[model samples]
Target chain A: MNYSNLFRIAIRALIRNKLRAFLTMLGIIIGVASVIAMLAIGEGSKQKMRGQISSMGTNMVMVMPNFQRRGGVSLGASSSMALKYTDVIALRNEAVDVGAVSPEIRASGQIIYSNKNTQTTIYGVSEEYLSIRKLEVLSGRVFNANETRSMAKVCILGQTVVENLFGKGADPVGLSIRIKNLPFLVIGVLKDKGESGMGQDQDDLILAPYTTVQRRLAAIDYINGIYASALSEEKSPAAIVEVEEILRRTHKLKESTENDFRVMSQSELLKTITSITDIMTYLLGAIAGISLLVGGIGIMNIMFVSVTERTREIGLRMSIGGRGKDIMKQFLAESIILSILGGVMGVVFGYLLARLAGSLMSSQAIVKTQSVVLAFIVCFVIGVFFGWYPARKAANLNPIDALRYE
Target chain B: MNTIIEIRNLRKDYHVGEVTVHALRGIDLKITEGEFVAIMGASGSGKSTMLNILGCLDKPTAGDYLLDGINVSSMEKDAIARLRNQKLGFVFQAYNLLARTTALENVELPLFYNPKVRARDRREAAIRALEAVGLTDRMHHMPNQLSGGQQQRVAIARSLVNDPVLILADEPTGNLDTRTSFEIMELFQNLNEKGRTIVYVTHEPDIAKFATRNVMFRDGKIYRESIVTERLNAKEILETLPVEVIEEFD
Candidate 1:
């Protein structure tokens, strides 16, 4: 028989039992949809993370302290033996590609006055710190460069801090708040930056000049860490190299001595997160793919049952000048048509589900076109591979015996 | 060599559990061209088995069977199918026409296997075959839409489509009344007059009267042979049968 006739016969036979055929296709539909949706969600999260990090300025880099060994003892970053505040001055003056440098001194405390006390984070840095960290003041005013030089007691509060310290009724500008019993006047209230993509509160801190923190509280001229902005995103790696060299030279370190700080660009952080998300996507896709395999086995089982159910019809066809290969071709065509139809429908349904999920959250629809193509290819292969044995069994039936069957 | 069918010492065995039932026991027979013959027997007397072997639908366990000068006993299964398609036609008792296919398509089925016949030619030939069996008006109707006699007529049309060397029919009129049975027999006679070889298997002696030759089987063997000493028409044969038998059959 020609391929068209085989296809026609197979399709007609399948359509004869509409409910069973539909039930059989349901397995394939579920399998394909699961695989598509899972891959899309995982890929969507990765994309969102990359977008958030990149928006924070690719030129931004972080410098954290590392352990230093005096004899043979090793320690961690919090050991107070690594980075220093003087390193920022050295990087700012000597590093060619550095644009701004600021030191961060952090301490958690409560500000209290007249029965109003609120817990908050206090950060210490220079006035250029606002520009370096991409923070903008919404009210009052930021401290000037001279204010930072003179170890002034001026401070800037973020939106959350202003809300907590002064409430909506009270004015925050020029108000005094006791910090560890040392009063400082609030010079500015920062803009409502809201939450970052990682769910960290961006407007929840109080910023004081670094000189005041060093002298009044810690009583040392050292810093916790440094934040530096590159001249441009394209020059970040060069700026990191320039800053590292300047610090090493000012510290008078030998060639054999290891640096006591870790310098990392924003892009490197983005890469680290992308690798993690990539692994997660693959793992979820694999788990969903197993259902596709199970769906294939279900098809095979039903096809075998179909062969047995129609043995007499098969014999009749064989007797009426049909070849064994014709029988084989008919059954194989039937299963392939079933799976391909299911795969096509599953792609549409999967996209609908993904779009619904994205819209419910007011987010972008995560449609990955490759997943549609990939799901179809895998399902088609499954049809052929799972359908072969049953088709062969039908083809190999004994014509005489089958004709004799009732 | 003029014989269209020749069987020598044909044997067929059926093993059901430990019991061995010999379905065909060393039967020897030869049917020449252009002869109408009948084999009559009681149930389980192997007349059906002989018809199956003659139609090439089954293989005999020990046999030397020749069909149109080819040794069918040694042919492979697929080659036997091809031989049946090319040289033999069968009309079954149950009128086993494909239920969902139209009469014209049913007649054209064997011709579909014969690719030498183009699609248009096959259609025309199927129409002509149906006309020859007096079913020209029912050509487009499915089997269930046709009566028992009309369905049998469609089957006869199918048997004639390929123009085989011989036709083997098993109980062709088994499901029909006396009037319809005679109508079919008349069609068979007319085809035989056109020089087609025909064999019909039956158990009713009166039905066997239509053929010029009769072979009766008993206990897996041909136990009697008889030629019609005097020709009898179907009406006359029905007229001679006892009224009790007719009433019981009705």
Candidate 2:
């Protein structure tokens, strides 16, 4: 018989027991739906991370003191204080790929403004720091080269710091705030930068000239870190290499000695984060695939039961000229129809579920076309793989024995 | 009359575990078109086995069997299946109509396996077969909705739908009441009179009397063979029986 006729017969048979058919399809539906939703959520979170990192400036690079071993005792990067203003000047002047460079020295202390006080970190940087870290001055100007050279007591307050010290939406430009009991003039209020991918608030700090923080507040000579930006995103790796070489040369490290500073680019961080999320996505997809395997088994179980139930009908068909292959094809068609229908429904259900979960989680859940296509191909293979044994059993049944079966 | 079935030394053996039981030891039979023959025997006397072999449902242990001039004894499973579809029809005692299917579809089933018949032609042939069995009015009813006699008639229509060279009926009336059995037999007789060949299998002597020829089996061998001198007409028998009153509940 033709395929159309076979499908018609298979459909009619399934319709005879609607509840059973639907129940069998339920397994496949749940399997495919979970796979789609899980993959979408994983992809969404990864994309969100990349977007946050890109906002931090795709070409941005950081040079921090490496963990130093002094007399077999390890001191972390924070306490090393190995970076210096000279290293920043060297990178700015010598590294062609480096677009901008800034030396950073931070001090955490209480700031008192008009009898209101809050604890926050004060980052000492130059005008280039704002551009490198994608910070913007909302009201006034940033600390320029003369201010950095003269150790001028001027600061730029982040939005959160501004709100905390000067009240919500308050313009604190030209205001004087006391930090570590020393008076500092606020030249500008930085625009809102929200939060980072690490869930840290980005707009909760104060910016000042590196010379002012080193001399006035902490009384330190060495800087904590150095931040720079590449001329373009594509030049970030080259910029990082240039910065590393300049720092190693300025530190006067021997040929066999490891550099005292570590250099990293924003794209590297993005890659690390996305790779982790990729693993999570596949792990989730594999877990969901177990359910699909179970669904395939469900199809096999139902097909076997159906074949047994219709033994006499098979015999009758055989007597009327149905070949073994015809009987096998009929049963296989029934299972394939069940699985493929479930797969289609699952794709729709998964897309909706992903959207719902995405909105609930306040993130975008992406449903890739490849995932849907893969689900369909998997469902088809599942249909055939699971439907084979039972169909063969039906085909191999002796016509006489089957007819005589009660 | 064309010879529709010819068998020589047909033997069928059944192996129950390591023990072998000879179901049909050695048998020779010939049936031609337009002849109504009944092969009758007691239970376990090999009548069923003989019918199975003749219908090509079972391959004999050693024998040559031909149906409509084609050697079917050594044919492969698929070839035999095609031959059965092309040249044979079957009516079982249980009616064997697919449950939940309309009588018309059940009748159309045999034609479904015939590649030569299109969907439209299949339906038309099924309708004609139902008309021949005088079940045209009940064609749309499911098998469960039809009475035993009507259900049997639908089965007869299914068997005739393919227009095969031979129709095999295994205890066609075994499940029916006497009146219904006679009605089905009358339908068979009517079809036979229209030049359709039939092979009927039953242990009932009265049922066997409806056929033109009777072959009896004892153990696994044919014990007796004879042409019916006084053939019993099912229509006359059915006419003499009391009418069944089907009560209608309002």
Candidate 3:
């Protein structure tokens, strides 16, 4: 038979039993929808992670002091911790495309101003620290090098500290606040930085001159870590190499020995975060695919039942000169049509579901076009692959026996 | 007269586990063009087996059966189907009208199988077939809407659609009342009188009396053969004969 005649017969047969045909297609619908929805969700999380990491200033490197502890008691690594004030100065002088490098000294203390009091972290660094960390001075300026040398009693307050200490809508510039029993003048109110991917608060700190923390808070000359920025996020590896060579030479570590400190660029941290998210997506999509396989099996079962039920009709057709291939082609075409229709509908619904989830998150839902296309193609393939056996059985039936069958 | 169908020492067998049942016992027969014949037999006498083999639906165990002088016993199934669609027409006891289809479409089916029949030509020929069967007014009605006799008329119309020279009717009118059976027989008699060759099977003596020649089978072989020179007309037999079929012709 020609294609149109076979198609006409298939359509008429399917329409004759609309409810059964719709039920048969439901499995394919669920399979396609889940595939699209799962992939979209996985892709969504990936983009979200990348965005969060990018929020942290890119191209920046974290240099922590390689502190050693013996017997659970702390002993400062003065020799191994080469990210010092001298190294910071050398970075500014020698390195090209090096934007800003600051030695960080942090101490936790309570600040008192009038009736308002709050306990927070106080980070002391050079004037370049604000620009490197992308922190803005909302109302005042960061302290200059003269302030660091003279050990000026100047500090910068984060948005949250300013709100708590001086009340809302009040500026704390040029005001004195006591930190760890040391009196300091507030030089600026830093800009508000949002939360990180690890859910740490970014706008709850205090900044002051590096020397002030050494003299008044820790009573030591050692630094905790160094925060260095590259000219651009894309220029991170070059900046990392420059920092490593300078720190290695400053520490004077011998050849064939592991470096005392771990230097992590922003890009490395971003990749680690992305890999974890991508794996989660894979796990979720795999679970969805298992259900899709179950759905394909469901189609097979329904097709077998259909063949058994239509046995007499099959015989009649065969007796009327319908060939085995004709019957097989008609049934297979019906199944493929049902699956493809279900897949198209599923893609539409899956995108809607993903969009709903994203709306609840106050973010845009991303529907990967490739995933939708793949879902449709897989549905068609599954229908043809699984539907062939039952159709073949219907075709191979003996006309004489089948006609006499009850 | 040219022999349209020639069967030479045809035999057919069936296997049930290890037992081989010989369904056709080396039967040789030749049917001339435009000859009306009746094949009669008791239950399990293998008449159905002969009919199936004659219709080219099943192959004989070892024989050469030729249709229109072409060897058909050994041809593959598709070729046999093509031959049947072109040369053979069937009328079974059940009428076998498609339940969901109209009388016209039912008649059109065999022509649809004939690749030589174009779509418009098929419709015209099917209309003519239905008119010849006296079912022109009921052409659009579904099979369920028609009586047993009318449905059988539709089946006859379907058989005539392809202009097949040989018409094979296996126990036609078996399920009908005596009056309806005679009416169907009259339709077949009229068709035969118009020079269409027909082969029919029957157990009733009254139905067999309608044929010009008779062949009786017992134990998978033809036991008796006769020519009824003064055959009873199926229409006259319906009017004069008793409502209950007489069994004396046995």
Per-residue lDDT of model 2, residues B1-250, tens digit only = 7888888998888899999999998888888889999999999999988888888899999988988888887789999998888788888888899999999989988787889899878888999999999988887888888888788899888888888889999999999988878888898899999999999899899999999999999999999999999999988877787787965322
Each candidate: how many clashes? 0, 0, 0
* TM-scores of the models, in the order given: 0.79, 0.95, 0.82
Q: Model 2 over residues A92-142: C-alpha lDDT tens digits?
A: 889999988888998999999987999999998878899999999899988
> How does candidate 2 fare on TM-score?
0.95
**Kept native contacts, fraction for each prediction:** 0.24, 0.92, 0.10
Which has the greatest DockQ?
2
Q: How many backbone clashes does candidate 3 have?
A: 0
User: Per-residue lDDT of B129-219 in model 1, one digit per residue for the tens?
Assistant: 9999998888888787888888999989888888889988889999998777887888898898899999999888877888989998999
lDDT at position A117, candidate 2: 94
User: Which of candidates 1 and 2 is the stronger one according to DockQ?
Assistant: 2
For all predictions in the order shown, the interface RMSD in Å is 2.5, 0.7, 2.2
Cα RMSD to the true fold for all candidates: 5.6, 2.1, 5.6
Top-lDDT structure, candidate number: 2
What DockQ does each candidate score versus the true complex, computed on alpha carbons? 0.31, 0.87, 0.27
Q: Sort by TM-score, best first: what order?
A: 2, 3, 1
Predicted candidate 1 versus true structure: per-residue lDDT over A41-159, tens digit per residue: 77877787777777676788778776666678766634454567778878878878888889988777887655688888788888778887788988789888787778787888887
TM-score of chain B of each: 0.91, 0.96, 0.94
